[model samples]
Target: MAVSCVRADPRLVEFNDIKIGHVYKKTVTLFQFTAASPAMVVVPGLLIPEKQEEVRDCLLIHVEDTETIKIPLLEFPKVCSLLVDSVLDFGCIAANNQVISKHHPITNKGTAPGAFQVQYSRDPLVTVSPCVESLQLAPPSG
Candidate 1:
């Protein structure tokens, strides 16, 4: 029985600045040449975690009656960038027992999603809307 295997195309795949709640995809191709009546090839899949971290690994492809082939994979750490206004001015207000509101915007400028919270404030009168411990912001689209 004679059998041969070819290396995967694009031998290495790199994912850079991947963000949580976002999906990235890659494809690899493998070729085989054999004279045997029946041949089998196995390709493995990868599963990445949701947390932000760096990953370096490889995929193993098994070919019957042949040596295993290796394809390298690299994943960079997640990054989140945000931009906020320097100052927010509420202006002057009388003590007439009236409610006042102001709008503040936060923008995400990085490739990954980000979470933020208003942890501290000196004045008791100051408050933020949607007062949740964690607020999620999606990355900007290109």
Candidate 2:
């Protein structure tokens, strides 16, 4: 038996301008051409369980079979641009066991919100404040 997509393209599913840390969904409808013989359409392991359920509910098939079709899902995230100083330098430090501090500024130049992360340095003496892994900055206009 031959199967084909009735409404949408079966080869690819594309999503555009998806925000980070957000969920988006799309459905593709498929039709089985021949009804004489039974056929099964399988969606492979690329998607999570929740997404699999969504696809299964939309598919028109009779029984579970080994025939599988791999569909590529493309997602484009919103872009965010950030500007920062090229270098941060501490001029000099005395051996008085004192904690000297400096300020570093990060500016978001893009319209979307930007997420920044400061990785830990190899030197144990060097540390970062607001020790979280990621921080989000709003757009300049906001």
Best TM-score goes to which candidate?
1
Total backbone clashes of model 2? 0
TM-score of 1: 0.44
RMSD of 1: 8.5
Q: Which residue runs of candidate 2 sit more than 4 Å off their true CA positions? A: 1-78, 131-142
Query: What is the lDDT for 88 in model 1?
Result: 71
Worst 10-residue lDDT window for candidate 2 reads 48-57
Q: Residue-wise lDDT of candidate 1 within 81-142, one digit each (tens)?
A: 76778887778877577777888877776666676666657878867775553335554368
Clashes of 1: 0
> What digit string (tens of lDDT, one per residue) describes model 2 on residues 1-142?
4664332346576555555445665555444445453333344323223221112222333323645445566655445667768887767877488888888777765545657777877889878875543335544473
Best candidate according to lDDT: 1
Give candidate 1's whole-model lDDT.
0.68
Q: Would you list the C-alpha lDDT of every candidate in the order shown?
A: 0.68, 0.53
